[model samples]
Target: MTPLLETRDVGKTFGSVVALRGVSMTVERGGVTCVLGDNGAGKSTLIKILSGVHAPDSGTYLVDGEPVRFGSPREALDRGIATVYQDLAMIPLMSVWRNFFLGSEPPARGPSRALGGFDVATAKRVAREELRRMGIDIRDVDQPVGTLSGGERQSVAIARAVHFGARVLILDEPTSALGVKQAGVVLRYIAQARDRGLGVVFITHNPHHAYPVGDRFLLLNRGAGLGEYGKADIGRDELTSLMAGGAELDELAHELRRTDTPS
Candidate 1:
């Protein structure tokens, strides 16, 4: 089968400042494509392009073998592309069920529909069911989202995307702010999402977080490509070294050695 999403020599620029150049990768269904980069390394730019927030200045962006030029994120969402940012886009004071159906609340039927309201029962039930499917257990659907742990909050976002039938899930630094255990918790959900056949674009600065769940890795530095590799083609140490631009470590070692030497 064809990849769910693919970019060929994709490039983007801000006025005279180039944000990305000649970068490319494929995101297949049931696969996790991890994009690793540091600040100003085009990670944000690439994600914005994928989520339809901005169009690339060069190269092609394809979805399911079709070239699509999405004018807005809503258009991307209509095409089954959902993005969950680092913040998870959740309201702290809202209930789990409320946040689950925040924007796309299910409409009621018959006379209730005439009253123009939501199907609260169905929403709560469905929210409970979906969370359970993702191995998330909430004490009460009425509990405020802020009351949930970081992992649970991220799980809720992932489940919401799944419930809405998102085909490709673009997660922007979902584990960035969490503790080790919490990050692992979120990673499990990401693996689950991949196993369920949704293409996942996981953007992160942590190679440790990305390596375990990532099937393929794409490294970006200074708005350019290092190379995309399958899991077998790379290792944890090498991935980290490359992300740090390889030789800076050697230079630092040399400098330290000189400093240690008697003058």
Candidate 2:
């Protein structure tokens, strides 16, 4: 089957700086594609291009085998591509239901609809249901989102995207800020999202976090791809080594050992 989303030989340049060069990856239904890279590895550039925040100066982007260049995030959303950023774009002080609906609230009926009122009842019910479906347990939808744990907040964002008909979910470093247990919880939710048949793009610097949940891995370094490998073709240790620049690390270790040796 054709991938839900695909990019081929994509590249971007900002002034004299090349943000990405010849990067390619694919997102398939019910699978997670992990983009592993450190800072300035062109991860952000790839995300922007995928989510329509910016266009690549080179190469083709396709959805279901048809080439498409989205003009804005809305266009991407219209195509069932949703991105949950690191900040999550949620209001801390707002109620869970409120944050879930945000700009896309269902209009209240009759006179209330004419008065620009939203269906609070429906929003609350659906938000709770969606969260439950994603295996996210919240005590109450009326409670302030700020009171939730970091993992819960990330799950909420994921659940929100899935609830809104997202076919391909792009998550930007969702586990980077949490403790080990909390990160595990978020990873579980990511697995849940993939099991539910949403193509997931998980961007992170941590290979350990990505390996267990990812079906495919795309390694990036200094705005270029190291390689793209399927889980069958790569092991966890190999993934980690590649992400850390294995040869470079080994050479550095040898140098350090030599320096510490007695004359």
Candidate 3:
């Protein structure tokens, strides 16, 4: 089977600074590809390239076995590539339905060819139905989105992307700010998206969170490729150690240890 998304020898640089180097990976349909890294790692850069925020300086991007270039985010969206950043991107003061249909509102039409514009009622009904399909039970679609929990907000964003026809979903640090239970809720939704046949690129620093849901893992350090491993080739502890800079961490811990002395 062809990968839903693939990057070959992808690299990005800013003036004299390199943000990514010869990075390559694939996200298959119905699978999760977890990109793990700590601060200053190239995880953000990789996602930007994938989501079309910035085109790679060199190398190729392929979607469904065809080469393509995304000049802007709209181009990526046109090709069914959607990204949900850490911020959830919802207007806190707006109603759930409003936020759901913010940029892509449905249109109202009569018999004539040039008949209509934003259909508020239809948008609300469709938003409610989409959320319901994802098993998200909202008390009131008219309530402010800020009224929902962090997890619920994230789930709403996911459902919005899926509803808008996102074939490849890139989630950037989705669980970084949530409590354990809330994070679990988001993870379940990630799995739900995967099960529904969307290629998921889950960018996170937490291995424990990634292990259970991820089908493949790509490790990065300091703008360079560390390695990419499948579930069968890696374990949680190994992933953690690599992200933490294994030997460097061990050396620091050893040097900081206090010794007991006798006179």
Assess candidate 1 and give its TM-score to the true structure: 0.98
Question: What C-alpha lDDT does candidate 3 achieve relative to the native structure?
Answer: 0.91
Q: Which lDDT tens digits does candidate 1 get at residues 52-81? A: 999988899999999888899999998899
Worst 10 residues of 1 by lDDT: 241-250
lDDT against the true structure, per candidate, is 0.94, 0.96, 0.91
For model 2, what is the C-alpha lDDT against the true structure?
0.96
Clashes of 3: 0
List the candidates' TM-scores in order: 0.98, 0.99, 0.94
- Candidate 2, residues 169-252: lDDT per residue as tens digits? 999999999999999999999999999999999999999999999999999999998889999999999999999999999999
Candidate 3 lDDT by residue in tens digits, 148-222: 999999999999999999999999999999999999999999999999999999999999999999999998888
Between candidates 2 and 3, the one scoring higher on lDDT is 2
Clashing pairs in 1: none
Candidate 1 vs candidate 3, lDDT winner = 1
Q: In candidate 1, residue 125 scores what lDDT?
A: 96
What is the model-wide C-alpha lDDT for candidate 1?
0.94
Error of 1 at 167 (Å): 0.8
C-alpha root-mean-square deviation, candidate 3? 2.1
